[model samples]
Structure formats: C-alpha cells, structure tokens
Target: MHPQRECDIQAAPTHLITLGAEVAATLSKDGSLSEVLQICSEIIAHYLKTTNVCIWTFDQKSNTLTRVAFGGKDIYTASLPKTIFCQEDYLENLKARLLPCNFRNTPFSSRLYTLVVENNLVGAIILFGKEYFTEIEDIVLGWIANNIGLAMERFLAREKQQNRGETLLLKLASKLRHCLDFNSILEIAVKEVRDLLQIDRCHFLWYFPYCQNPRITITHEAQDSNLSSLLGDFSAERINTLFDKIRNLEIIRIDAVRESSLDLETQEMSIDLGITSLLLIPLKTHSGQFGAIACSHCNGSRYWSDSEVELLQAVCDQVALAIDQSEFYAQTRASALAAQAQAQQLTQALHKLQHTQSQLVQQEKMSSLGQMVAGIAHEINNPVNFINGNLIHAKEYIEDLLELLHLYQEHYPNPARQIQDKIEDIDLEFLLEDLPKLLSSMRIGADRIRLIVLSLRNFSRLDEAEMKPVDIHEGIDNTLMILESRLKGSGKNRSIKVIKDYGNLPKIECYAGQLNQVFMNVLANAIDALSEAEEKFQIQNMQIHIVTKMLDSDSLIIRIKDNGAGMTEEVKKRLFDPFFTTKPVGKGTGLGLSISYKIVVEKHGGTIECLSEPGKGSEFIIQIPVRAIASFN
Candidate 1:
C-alpha cells in the first residue's frame, strides 16, 4: 500500500469502510456498465472531496484506453486525451500496477488507479485536484477500481454476444443489396433471420398502404421442423387489428403472451399459432409502411433481446427497398409496351385516312364528268332525231317529183325551147342519177350519229336513281363505244381490237350509274395499257378481251384483259392502293383504279382483283352479285 493510503486508513477507517461498501453495492446492481460507473464515480467524489473523476475502458485488440464515463469536473478532462494508446510506455506499464502515476502535466495534482480483474487489465479510474490521500481513502479507491473491473468484464461479454447478431445482420444486408427481385428478397430475408435467431418460425406479410382495405398476404416463410404454417391463417378482421399496430411503426414484442400487456384476442391467437413469444418488425421507409416481419418462438416462453430485434428490423428495411425497385421496373416495362401499341394504331389510322381522301376526290371528278356527258347527250339527241325524221320525208318528195318530170318528158318531148336550153346547161341526165345516192349517204350518216348519242346516254345513266335491274352487256357495250377514239391509234398504229365473250346472263340488279362508271374505268385502263404496249413493244397485235359470264345463280363475273406492258409484282401489290401509281406525275392521277375498286367492292358489295406479269397481258376480274343485296343512298 502507498504511504498516503496508510495514513488515510488510520485517520478515518470507518468513512473509508463506508465508501468501499457503497462502491461495492453500486457495482453489484444489474444495471448497464456506464450507469454503475457513474454511480461509483459520484460516491467516490463525495467521500474523497475530489474535484474531477473519469473512468476509462481498455481495448486489448487495439491496445488503447477509452474514457467511458466522466462524473465530475469537465475543464480538467478537456485537455486530457479521451483515448490513450497502450503502446506508450506509461500506459503499457499500467497493466502490471494497482496504482499508476498521473503522467499528464496538469495545473492540479492527479492520481490514476489501474483496474484489473482475473489477472487482466479491464479498465482504470483517474482523479484530479487531489494533492494528497490518506491510507484509508487509497484502500477504498483500490476496492472500487476492482469492483469496476469486474463489472466491465460482464458488460463486455454481453457486448460480444450482441456483435454476433450484428455481424449476421451485416452479411444479410450485403446479400439483399445485390438482389432486386421482390419475392426473392422476402425469401432470403425471412430465412436468414429465422436461422440467425434460432426461432420457431419467421414469415413476411405483404400489403399496400394505398388501398381502401389492404390485404396482408403471407408471401414467404421459414421455420424449424414439425412446425405448423401460419399461411392463410390471418383473416381480414385479424389483419386490420394487426396492421393498425404495424402502421404506427411500432415493434411489437411479446416475450410471453400470458404475461404481456397485449389484448386477450392477440394473446389467444398467438397461442393458437403455437407462438409463446413474438417479435414483429414493420417494414417501412420515409414514404410509408409496406408490411411486417413476424418472428415466433413456439417451444416455450422466450425472451427477445434488443440485438435480435435490431437484426430483424435491419433486414426488413432492405426488403422494403427491393420491393419498391421491382415495382418501378414493372411499371416502366408496361408503359413502354403500351406506347408501342398506341404508335402502331396511329400509323394504321393515318393510312386509312389517306385512302379515304383520295377516294372522295375521285368520286367528285366522276360525278362532274357524268353530269356533263348526260347534258351533251341530251342536247345532241333531239337534233339528230329531227334530221333523221326529215330525211325520210324529203326522200319520198324527191322520188314523186322525179316521176312527174319523167311523165312531162314523155308528154311534151319537143314543146319548150327554154326547157331544152336549161337541160343542156345543167347536165340533166347526171343530176338525176346522183340525187338518190346523195340522199342515201345523208341517211346513213344520220343513223351513225343517233347510235353514238344512244351509246353516250347509256354510258352516263345520271337520270337513274337507286339500284335497278339493267343489262350488264349494254353497259359494257356503251363503255366500249365511249372509248372508241382511244381504241383507234392516233397515227400509224393500228386500232386496238376488242374481243367480246358475252355470256348468257339475266338482267342484274345494280346501281346503273356507278356500275357504268366501273366499266368505263376498266375499259379506259385497258386502252391505256394497250397504247403503252403499242408505243414500247411496237408488236402488231393489240387486243382487249371483254368476257362476261354467270359465275353462279347469285353472282356474275366480268374479265377485261389487255395485251399491254404489264406491271411488275411490286406495282401490282399496290395496284388498288390510293395514290400509288407507276405512271409519271401529271400524266396519271393514280386514283382511277382505286376508285374503281371502292365502287365495285364497297358500293356494290362485289370483288375486283388484278392478275398480271411482266411482258404478259394484264387482266382485271370483277365479280358482282346478280341481285344487289347492299342497301345504299
């Protein structure tokens, strides 16, 4: 013992004994290491009249001494090292001594008492502003340091146990950080937590907070052998009660259901599930709660440590983050698919609109042409009829006059010298012979004009309203007559010969004007094709075969084929697509064939298709129902 402690023990032995008893009693309590140290510090300071006191713990791993508690004056400790390296000679020598010297250069006197337990350096206590110490005071402090060392040993052992759980939590968090799948995250979390804690069962319940009444679903579970599953055991009413607590971000820990403050219903339900103790950690972030993780012990009533609760809560946090990430990924993928579908629909709509616009323009042009042709046919038909009627009357009057002249010639053969002079001057014999031939030529010309006017009226059936039964052959013939000028080549080229294969067909019910327009379009295209072929190939034979036949009782077919410069497969594919033309710009409007298709297919509820190959003839096949069944305006 130090000389000063010996003097102190003799001067105040009872007070010294009392201080030792109080310090021993404080360290013996089942409180935290810091709490006990703080109480011991106060007791020592009060009895000794010390100005400053601090307790430091020793870390053998790092060879450092760290101040764990300070119970007195703060100004003295402000300049002192909160942590001191044990590698220093002064601190290294502390492990072998009961009373170490105060080596720090301070304004006041200082003392250091090294604490040892079971032949190991656990911690120490330092006192400042104490100029001298009696023998009894030194002895009491020695007893207090010993008690503090023993208390630190117990606390360190408990801390080592906590570190084990913390290490496992860190490892589970590392695995979770690498995983982004929601279900996989839940599976890994529950299994690792149950295994680490050695619990009876562990499960994850999933729910969405945004719903009116969110359902808590058991998504994943891990358990020991012979344990009953809690899957599908939570009813909606039970979930509501359970979720109310979870949503508050509370960690509900029931060490023993019968002893805990939980309601009877929860206690009974827990017992039914073989759960004597339960720990539930809510999975949440700053946004909102996602779900909860339930850990249960079924063997008997078990106590849940703080370290265990902390480990499970940390794992649940990682699970919530992974779930949020997966939900975002799924939403992004769905949005991309929806956008692609919408883009395709828009492209199709635009194509349809273009076709409709082209068809409307073509229909307008055809309507104007039909009106003009009907007017011309009307104006010319009357004059031609008048000329035709007067020719017959004039022929009869000239023949009667010629017979009278002949009778006069017989009655007065030598009577009038003036008449004889007129006959000699006018060449009477030639005049009588040519007069009848002139009348015959005039009558033939008038008949040709009448036939042309009739063909025009037939081609432009503008006066007819609604669908009616009309001669299909007559429509074809009228279209042919209208295209006669094109069929005849302009210069040295020969006329395009048309071969008609008329079939025995009944009168079909159809729109007269529209059907006539279809025939006109087909014949016009045939003439144009033959003209192009004549210009390019220059082969002598140019023929268009117009064939009509009764395909069945309800339908009829018309085929107009031409020996022309037939189109390639590429052009044929878009042959009836509006505004898709092989002809050069300004020469062709590109709507002729498309409008013809609409009139045949849409207007008449019929079918029209083209078949052709390069250098071969092109054929347009139209199949119309014999009796038009489609109602129209």
Candidate 2:
C-alpha cells in the first residue's frame, strides 16, 4: 500500500498474456513446422520490440548452428559469419555445462545467450542491443526459449514420423516393382495406407480410355449394406471433377461428407457406407493419365494433414511408375513372342512352296517324256510295218520256189539238151548255197524290228506303281536302244563307239520308270555331245563309255563318260539349275539335266555329280540307294 513507483514500470496486462497465448496456440496448431517456426519468430520479434530476431538450428555434420528462422530487415548480411555458432567455439563448453554462456569478447561472440535442453544445446537466440535486457525481459526471453524448444521437439517428432512413413512407402514401392498385376498392387497399397494412416475406408478407382464410366470401390473395417450395394455403381463424374480440381495442385478438403451437395450420389453412397470424410488423390503417369486413389475416413470428421497428402502423392507416383514399367515389359514380351511365331510360320510356308515347285517340275518332265514317246512311236511304226510285210512275202516266195524245184526234178527225169543247158545257165550250186543265207538275213531283220519295238515300249515305262525290284542292266539296255539311232552317225558317217562296261549286279528295289528316265537323259546328252563334236571337228573317232557297278548291298553306281568338248566351269556350276543350258535355245529345253538330277538324287535318294575340264571331256556319276522306301499307304 505504501509502494510508489519511481519508474513507470506498469504491471503487464492480462490481455497481453492472452494475446501471446492466442498467438502461441495458433503457432502450435499449424500442420507445417516451417510455418510454425515463422509464426514463433514473429511473436518473439513483436513482443521483444527488436529490430531483428534470428532462430538457428544445429548442423551436426558442420558442427555449427545455422539460421533456420529470421525476422526483421537486413539481419542476414553479407559480412556476418557463415554460421553464428560452431562446435569449435561452443562444443567443449557445452560438454561441461547445461546453460549456454555469452561470448561477447571472443571470436564466437553474441549478444544473446540461452539453453534449450540439457546436453542438447539447440541454438542461440540472437538479439541486438544489451541495454534492452531487464527482469521482465529475461522472463520474456525464457518464455520464448521454452516455446521454441517445445515447438522444435514436436517438429522433430513429426519429422521422424514422416521419415518412417516414407521408408515404409519406399518398401511398398519396391514390392510393387516386382508385381505386374495392377489389382494386387493396388490392394496392397490401399491396405498399407489405411493401416498406416489410421483411416477407416480406402478405395481405388481405375480410369479406362474411351469408357464412359470406370470405378472400383473398396471398404475397410465397417461396411454399410446399402453402401456396399451402391458402391459398384457410383458415378464417375465425381471422380472426374475431383481429378480436375487436384490436377491443378488444389487440395480438396471435404470436412463433412454428408454436408457436400456437389455429388449427391457419392454423398448418399458415403452416408450408406457410414463415411464421414473422404480424400481422393489422382494417380498420374509420366506419359499420360492413369486413375485415382480414394481414401475414406469413417466415424468422425477428418482433416487431411499436410504430411498425409504428401505421402499419398508419393505413393501414387510410385504406383504409376510401377504400372508403366509392368505394361512396357508385358508389351515387349508379347511382341517378341509374336515375331517368333511369325518367323516359324514363314519357314513352314517356304518349305511347302519348295515341295510344290518340285512336284510341278516333275510333272512337266513327265509331260515332255509323253510327247517324246508319241513321236518315237510314230517314227518306228513305218519301219516295223515294212519289215513285217516284207518278211511275210519272202516266206511265201521261198515255199513256192522249193515246190517248183521238186516239180522240175519230176518233170525232167532224164536231161534233154535244152533242159541241161538251162540248168547249167541257172547255176544250181550257187542258188542252193545262197537261198539259206537270204532266208536267215530276212529272219534277223524281223527280229531286229521286234526288239526295237520292245525297247521303245520299255523306255516309255509310264506305270505309276510302287517301287519294285529292277535290273540296272535292263534299264541301261533300254536307254541304249532308244538312243541307238542318234548314236549311229547320220547320212552314212562313222557311228559313235558305245563301249559298255557293266559289272554283275542283282535286282535292286527302285522306281524303275524314274531310273530309266535318268539313264535316257544321261545317255542322250552324251550321244548328242559326241555327235556334235564329231561333226564339228570332222574327226570320226567319237566314243561314249558307260559303266555300271554295285557299290554295296545298299547302293548302285553308274558312270557315263564322253570324249567331247567339255563344259566350262561356269556351265558346270549352273548345269543342274532348271532352265539353264549351254545348248542352243531351240535345241534344248534346259530342263533335261535338272530333271535328271532330281530323279537320281531327290526321287531315288541318290547323288549325281559331274567331272569335266575344258578341252578334255565330260563325265557324270550317279549313286543310288537301293533300299525300298516304306509305302505311305
């Protein structure tokens, strides 16, 4: 009652404390630690009436206190120390005491000093001017320190929680990387987020291109029967609107799901599901858009914290990346498999085409042979008919002459002078000797005609029967017979000498008709070359040598050689190619050697090759397998 204030030290107002309480409460309520720190610094600066206030935090790596929060102008100047506090300046002192000391005269000097926690010195709070310090000033400084320390502790705790959540998200992302199934990964992501964030409901929706409506609903913990039924048919318009809003970095906070009238159907469905709050985040990929993740909270109103939104965004990014990678891998594998299948199909088609082409070529050869057979038959008919008629007339004439000779013997029993003279004139001894020789010659001519006809028929062996046992000698003989006229020199010139050196062989199972064609082609070519050379060189010594031998129980070998102008290496190379020939265009069809090669090698499962040199001659060797092929029937 007797106290009279010397100085105007008025009692601090309750409203001032109330205002500080309100400011502190507002700062503590903020979701972001950075904003909270800025708000704390503002409160401190306003209360202290200082031109500058700086908040610093410890940097463990640099062992320094770095400015984290600052208020007022030009406080962060160019000439100030990079760090206001350092371990070299204060760490030793800190190890020995709990309170920070002022260092005004030392290199690490500051005007303000404070302790944050025991053995965990946070940082120094710096204020300019020491005259402003007093009892009330210290109280204010203590309150500032206490408030900042509390805020920092809370901020650190929140940071650790956020880090743990990020770590779990990364682990989930790693698992999602191994998975290609979208639904399974989505389920895992939703379940993890629901449990980790402590939300009541979590659902995922996938947007499909060109689809009018696409949505997937999920419920966690509790399900409303009506809501469960209506979830499947939930309107996609709400999702679209939500996506458009969030795509622009706008946060959509629906504090009360029941109160939002924007999507009536969604609202009703949420009410049915007993959902009080819902947060939906869009899932986007690098290329384009994917869909969205809808997380719901039941039982009470829900506010989406800033950290949760950040986590959901991260998870959505991870899911999008994983899905994109999976789709890429799936498409690549499919394309590879499709290419392989196409290659296999092309290979099969090529094989069939080759087979059909071979068959067509064989048929063409047979047609050519048919035409040749008809021509040869027409040529042989005239000679055959002449020989037959001449032999018949000659037989009658011989019989009548024998009877006349007997009659003459009876009529002229004793020789008269005229009769004896006539008989002497006739030269009876010569007639008797010459008659037998003339008849034998006629018979030989008839036999020759018959043999020629038989050979012609055998050469055109058209029977399409199964492979049968065939005599190689017969085939060679038939070929020679058909080629004999060509072999003999035309217009009374010297004939080619065909030297046959045939070894003893057994009948081998083979397509006789095809083998006959092979022989005919080889022998005909040899005769033609030899004759052409003989005519060209005017040298009559033309020769063709044919040799046959049984190589083994399973094979037969044939060689045909000619002493004619040999083929060049270039000609030899294309000798077996269809439609390739050295002969004049009209003289050869160019298919003879090609067809011969096919018959000897492909049809008979044998080999045909040539040996020749320019200025020498040409030789062709054929080796045939004698084993019978199994009948397809």
Candidate 3:
C-alpha cells in the first residue's frame, strides 16, 4: 500500500470514535425505536454531506427489508419507497461488487451498508451522494452501522418485554371484572402480580381511611411455599412512613432495603422479615377506602423494571374498583333476601283469603238450596202418605161393591125395562172393570212421590252436623238424582249417559254434608262439560262414568270421568285455582273444583287430581282416608 493511504487507515480511528460518540448519545436518549433510528440517519447524513439517508430493518425470518426511518433533504425523502426486497435488481449489483452503485435511474450514486450485530445482518443503511466514499469514510460507516444494530436489538427486546407485561395485566383486569367477593379479588390481584413479576411473595394490606390513626391488616397473601407467611396486623404508627405514602396514593419501590433512603427502623424491620427488595403499590377506591399491595423478594436483591412497576400499578387500580363494587353488593344482598321472603308470605296469605271467600259463597248457596228442597219435601211427604194410606182401604171397598153388583146381576134374571135403561145410561159393567185399575194407578203415584222425598232428604244431610259413618255411594247417587235434569236429552242436545262401577267399600267415617257437597260439584262440572261439547262438536254418546274402589284397608278412591272435550295442559294446570273459569260469566262460579279440592285434600286429609287431555276427556280422582284423622275432623 502507498504511504499516504496507509497513514489514512491509522487516522480513521480518531474520526470514527468522534462519530461513534455522537451515535451513542442519540441511542441513550429516551425515545421510541423509530425516533432514535431517524436521528441516527440524520447524523450520518450530515457527516457524509449526502442528499438523503434511509434505514431499513431486515427480518431474517421473513427475508425482507422494511423501511423504518428517513432523514436528509425533504425533496429526496418524499420520493423514496417505504419498502424494497433484499434481492431487488437495484440491490443485486451492490451485493455482488460490494461497492457504491447508481440506484434505478437516479442521477446520484447510492452506497448500501449492512448493519450487523454478533456477525449477523440486522438492518441496512443507504446513503445518496455525488462523491464516492474514501477508505476512511467506509471504515467509519461500518462502525456506525454496528452501533445501530446493537440499538435495534436492545429496543426490540424492550418492546417484547413491554408486550408481555401488557398481556398479563389485561388478563388480570378481565378476571377482576368477573369477581364479586372482596377477599377473592384481593387474592387474585396479588397472585397475578407476583407471577407476572416473578417475585418471592405478594400480599394485600387492608386499611380504613375514615379511622383516626388508622390500622392495617394483611388480609390476603400469595407467596412461594417455602416462604413464611406475612399475615398479621399492625398499628398505623408502626409503619408511619409507609402509611403516609399510602395516604398520598404513592407507589413505594425499594431495590434493596439496606440501600434505600428509608428510616433505619423500616430497613431493619424489612430485613427481619427477610425482604431484600420490595415494591408497594397503593390503591384508593371511589368510595374512599384505601389499600396497598406489597411485592417482595426474599432470596436476593431484585431490580424492579419500569415495565413491571407500571403493570402492577394498573392491576392494583382494577382491584380497587372491584373491591368497591363488592362492598356495595354485600350491602344490598340482605335487603334482597328480606324482600323475597316477604313476597312469599304475601302470596300465601292472598291464596288463603281467596279460598275462604269461595268456601263461604259455596256454603251459602248449598245451604239455601238444601233448606228449600227440605221444605218442599216435608210439605209433599205428609199429604202423599195420607193419600197412600186411604187408597189401600178404598181399594178393598171398591172390590166388595163390584162383587155385590155382579151377584145381583146373576140372581135377578127377569129385570125391569127401567132398570135396563139405567144400566145402559151409567155403563155399569165398564165402570166395574176400570174402577179397580184407577185405584191401583193412584197408589203407584203416591209411592213415587214418597221415593223423591226420601232422595231430597238424604241429599240435604242437614241432621248430621258432625262427621259420621256414611256410605260414600249413597252421597254420589243423591248428587246424580239432583243433576238428572242436566243429564236427559232436551231439544237438539243429546242425553249424557251415566255409568256406575260401584265397589264394595265399607262405610267411611267423614263429614257427610261436606262430602255430599263435593259430589254435587264434580257431577255438575261433568254435566256442564258435556253440554258445551254438545254445542261445539255435537258429540254423540256423551258419557260420565262414576267409579268407586277401595285402594286398601286404610283408603278409598272415587273417580269421576267424562267423555267430553278435554282441557289443554295450560288450562289443566290452573283447573283447581279459585275463580278460574272457561264458562260464560253468569253460567259458572268457577269455585266448584277448588272447593272440592280443599274438602277432599285439606279437610279429609286426602289427595285429589284431575287427568285431562285435549279432544280426549278429563278424569277427577279423589282418594280419602277410610277413617278420618282426628285432627281433620
């Protein structure tokens, strides 16, 4: 080599060092990756007196170059493309010869410098200038390129770390939003912070802000298994410095307790608790409650990064809001429970009131009808008995008179003409033949009247005020007799047939009057159902079947079924509810089945249910105890 050229190589270090110091100052400043890269490009462009300078970071995984920063004259920078391929035609000649070359059709020549760290390409810098680079300039550019590579690597690592912290903080916030329990929220906050920062222990300090010289308690703790617990209570004065900081809503970070500018006592106390490094993030909720989270390092001193501190502070803020909401919920829960219980009680009382009203109305109607029927029966019974008794004697007298007339007719062969004319006028022989038949018909009519009086008296059961042994079948039969008018065909309506399947049941001890009322209600409902069906579908052969059977020694079942239009499921569900009816307003009172259910189930300690389906039929099954329980009676 020539002597001057060789000397220039030795002189290159002094200039390179000056340029390197400028680049270092730019990298050290607090700025984002792109900003720092732009400043670096500007510094290099000024030193070279170039037209333009641009930097592109290369991603080895993608094998692509992405333009990141630009500096130099605005006129030249505006025309530059934001990205280009590493193997583009313009770059191929530069890569092959490792020299400055004209880029595309531009008048100025461009030099491509690869920025490398650890002998691997991380990025490239391009410079546009009129003059080619000298040997010393090339050496200085290589040094600057290496510094840029190192800066890019450091910023990339920091960005990745920040992204990770952000992800964890987001996860913690999402979990806190779903949590309602106070202690659980605190536990999750501390545990997540500890795991995110990889610390030895984390705990929450709960304090009341309203109290004078407030006290604090370590309410929740999350730590490594090998560490001792920090669960305890302390007076406010014990850690006055910490309390003051929390009151101010300040974060306290101590890299090493021994080296921190804390009071001597706090330092010693922290050491005693085996804390080499500590970070405390204070929280103040909207309701004025205050708390703090303490993250500690027990094994060795730890450097708490800025990113970690920021993430923990964010998590603490979310936790404070959750605690405030949980406290409000706790206050409202008791009132909610009380209101629910009161609602239940009111519903039950209303149901009882309705039942009592229906019972009173039904009893009044039944009592009035029974009294009228009894009065009519009594009035008719006495006269019918009188006529029936007299007819027996009258029949004998008529027979004797007829026999004497026949004897006279046989003995007096020669009768006067006047006697014969009188006989023709009176029709004597016809009278003798028809008179006895007339008396017989009168006796049968009186007997029918007596039978009807007996049925009316049986149905009323007014004499039996208390429960007594009664034939269940007799009460049912009486109810049928009363409803006979509804059963028979009239006009266009078809007759509803009655089918009875009586079982040999023993006399059951029950309230006969009330039991009879139940039979009346059920049979009346069946007749009404058939009547409606007759109009709608004109059902032929409509029938109501009365089935009775002894289920066992202790109980008996009475089933009353009708082959009429059945009810829907929704109607069946509320079938026995009081004042619920499908009939026209005046046609039905709607209390029949409800009253029957109460009498059978509540009064007699029995069960009653209706089985029904649409277009099929409905069946009411009532099961009563054989002997009435003493309490029910």
- Can you write out model 3's per-residue Cα lDDT over 245-293, one digit (the tens) per residue? 8889888999988889988777877888899999999998777878899
Taking all chains together, the TM-score of candidate 1 against the true structure is 0.60
lDDT, residue 270, candidate 2: 66
Which portions of model 1 show Cα errors greater than 4 Å?
1-204, 208-215, 219-245, 248-267, 275-289, 292-326, 329-359, 400-435, 630-633
Residue pairs in clash, model 1: 5-134, 5-135, 6-135, 7-135, 8-134, 8-135, 8-136, 9-135, 9-136
- Judged by lDDT relative to the true structure, which candidate is superior, 1 or 3? 3
Q: lDDT winner among the candidates?
A: 3
Cα lDDT tens digits, model 2, 82-123, are 364454557556322321333233342233554366566666
Q: 455, model 1: CA deviation in Å?
A: 2.0
Root-mean-square deviation of Cα positions for candidate 1 versus the true structure, in angstroms: 11.4
Lowest lDDT 10-residue stretch of candidate 1: 95-104
Best by TM-score: 3
Whole-model Cα lDDT of every candidate shown, in order: 0.79, 0.69, 0.83
TM-scores, each model vs. reference: 0.60, 0.50, 0.81
**Model 3, runs deviating above 4 Å:** 1-21, 50-54, 60-65, 71-147, 173-188, 209-215, 219-222, 229-237, 305-308, 324-342, 379-438, 630-633
Candidate 1's error at 109, in angstroms? 54
Cα lDDT of model 1 by residue, 89-153, tens digit: 75556533312334354445556888777767888888865567755566767756766787789
